[model samples]
Target: MKPMQSPLQHTQGGTSSGHRAWSALIGPIGLAMAVGVAYFLGARLSLALLTKPDGVAVFWPAAGIASGTLIALGPRARLPVVLGVVAATIVANILGDRNFAAGVVFALCNAGEALLVAGLIQRTFGREFRLESLRSVVG
Candidate 1:
């Protein structure tokens, strides 16, 4: 008699269960790293591009990075990515002499923007969607 294989054991393309588990664990870590790097780069660029008395940048690079990350990571990675963004935002704000309340608010806005972008992309194109052409742009 043949032995029954568990669902997890039947990994796609013969990948091992241990490998899949490691990848699952690493995905969030990579997201966190990406968020941190994006935040840092945004802060530097914002400081360099400061022209107004309010010190706001003409382009917030972190916003685009966060949105792109959320889109690429998919729905399953939302929580971790949001948490990472919040942490990065708060740290950046505090280091830049901003208050905790402001940091929290800004973090919330950043998170909300990422969620909105990700949800729109997912809803408009489904999970297997790709921004590959003019149709994707139009959509």
Candidate 2:
């Protein structure tokens, strides 16, 4: 004496093992893509802005991108995001012809800066924070 379930209902609410497996695979793949693209763009821009022999860029967009990614992905994905950033950093340095040791140090600094920025922004503005507001600009 039970009612039958609709296909839509089953697809939407059922705990199918297939759905779980897809999500598990897709999430990491998606995250890796996002990180790789962001890191590549940021590193390229930073290299373009390099104005001195010391290898420092006039403006490091990677820092901002890393921070923004961390914010968007929330805290659960920090390690992976940072790892992506570090990999990107090493790649950038190698392409720019810098030494391996220098690349590692620079990557560490960039990741640390991104982590600090993300933590501060999350703590100050909660999860609803946005940079489009004047308040966010001022704060």
Candidate 3:
């Protein structure tokens, strides 16, 4: 015989669900560093080709990477993703010879945008989100 899960438990993925254990198992630093390195590489690659006259990429893939990192890792990853995004953004811009102040500002903007998009996805699709509905695409 097996114990029954509550309807809410079956529908929602949160602390009592499987995802939290990964965060606990990996610990905070590991997650941050992994996301940071991935973001940094992604930013660097995009900058190499997409940079405009002002040193800004025409399309910043790092923002998508950060947002996807947060959404996939769930709510627990927001801080690490933010740190990764900001650090990666500033470093990539600096390496490309952008002004320090501009890099700082750009980093903040990139982080903010990723956070906002991730929040919207979390709201629309829940923590364990899926691409199951038109709302996910249209919204």
Candidate 4:
């Protein structure tokens, strides 16, 4: 008689377990990489077009990108989102001709800013937050 397998079990045997694990990892990895790339590009664009003689940007859209990503992903995905923000911020600052120390500091500050914004929004409106109402946006 053939061995009976649970419905939850994969029919592909040993290799399928590894494949499943790898695929699970791929989702987070891909999200991180996409966020990193987006952050880097946004920062670069803002620095190029909006930076002044004092090295401050008139508008920094990267912050919005990071904060929006954090809020969209929620607390469960905070690790990967922050990681991507940190990596991208560091690289963007370095490529923008800042020193290594400055890059690291800027990266930390940017990530912290994103976290703070996301935290405040979550606290105010809960996890299922939507900016559909005026109170949600202003308050």
Candidate 5:
């Protein structure tokens, strides 16, 4: 006689146990919002200094780093948060002054901030996406 198989065995595994929507959108959206707020605040604070050509040197990078680091700290959201920070920083720079030089500065600062924040999280909170090691046992 042939062995019986369950109907579910033929399917592509069971339904996902993790979040479907938050994993898709909330994290990235939150990061974008935070970056926007930071950028505007930075721009406003630097307005007086930005009156001179050299004063454009001050705000954008600081804003990008601060916002990016904060966003990366959310749970189960490392990937989206980091990407959103970069995207928002670039968008903010482009829309604020529409210049390549300023855009590059924002990019570098955002990248640095993401790296630093990710490293700290990995070291302190323990990595959530690591493979588990198998243990040996005697019967």
Candidate 6:
């Protein structure tokens, strides 16, 4: 004879059905802000690090690597983080130059780099770090 799982226990394995609607709206909304901030900060940090050198203008790509790795490995919010960051970078470029060409390049290259890194992480790590795993380990 097996014991029946309580409703709470059964629902705890994944996101709850009731919260699915809330997640639909809030998840992307929150990720956008986080990605924007991460991208901005990542780019700014790279720019500052490379400011002393001349003829080295790969700041956006380098920042993408850092930001992407952090987003993909540091959290499970890789896609949203990268998207938000790329969008913000494009917007910043357009604002600065009033042209979309450079922005497009930056967005595409950064996103590509991020995707590559994310794929590599997924392959290397076997699986993403999960909240339940952490909880079990901690408890």
User: 53 in model 4: Cα distance from truth in Å?
Assistant: 2.5
Give the winner by lDDT: 4 or 5: 4
Question: Can you give the lDDT of residue 24 in candidate 5?
Answer: 40
Count of steric clashes across candidates, in order: 0, 0, 0, 0, 0, 0
Q: Note each model's CA RMSD in angstroms.
A: 5.9, 6.5, 6.4, 6.8, 12.5, 8.5
In candidate 1, residue 89 scores what lDDT?
A: 83
TM-score of each: 0.76, 0.77, 0.73, 0.82, 0.45, 0.58
For candidate 1, lDDT tens digit of each residue in 1-139? 5464332233355668797787766666776776777766685566467676887767778887778877876776787778878888887787777899998998899889989988998998888778788877787
Model 5: residues >4 Å from true position, as ranges? 1-24, 37-48, 59-75, 101-105, 117-139
Model 4 stretches astray by more than 4 angstroms:
1-20
**In candidate 2, residue 35 scores what lDDT?**
82
Better of 2 and 3 by TM-score: 2
The best candidate in terms of TM-score: 4
Per-residue C-alpha lDDT of model 6 across residues 101-121, encoded as one tens digit per residue? 888787777767776665655
Off by over 4 Å in 3: 1-26, 51-56, 133-138
Give one digit per residue, the lDDT tens place, for model 5 in 5-35. 3221222334353543433455456655665
Displacement of residue 29 (Cα, Å) in model 6 is 2.1
lDDT of each: 0.76, 0.77, 0.75, 0.81, 0.51, 0.59
Give lDDT: candidate 5, residue 41.
54
> Residues 55-94, candidate 4, lDDT per residue (tens digit)?
7877778889889988877885677778888999899888
Candidate 5 clash pair list: none
Which model, 4 or 6, shows the larger TM-score?
Answer: 4
For lDDT, the strongest prediction is 4
Per-residue CA lDDT of candidate 3, range 28-95, in tens?
A: 56766777888889888888876556655666677778888778777667877788778878888899
In what order do the candidates fall by TM-score, top score first? 4, 2, 1, 3, 6, 5
Is candidate 3 or 6 superior in TM-score? 3
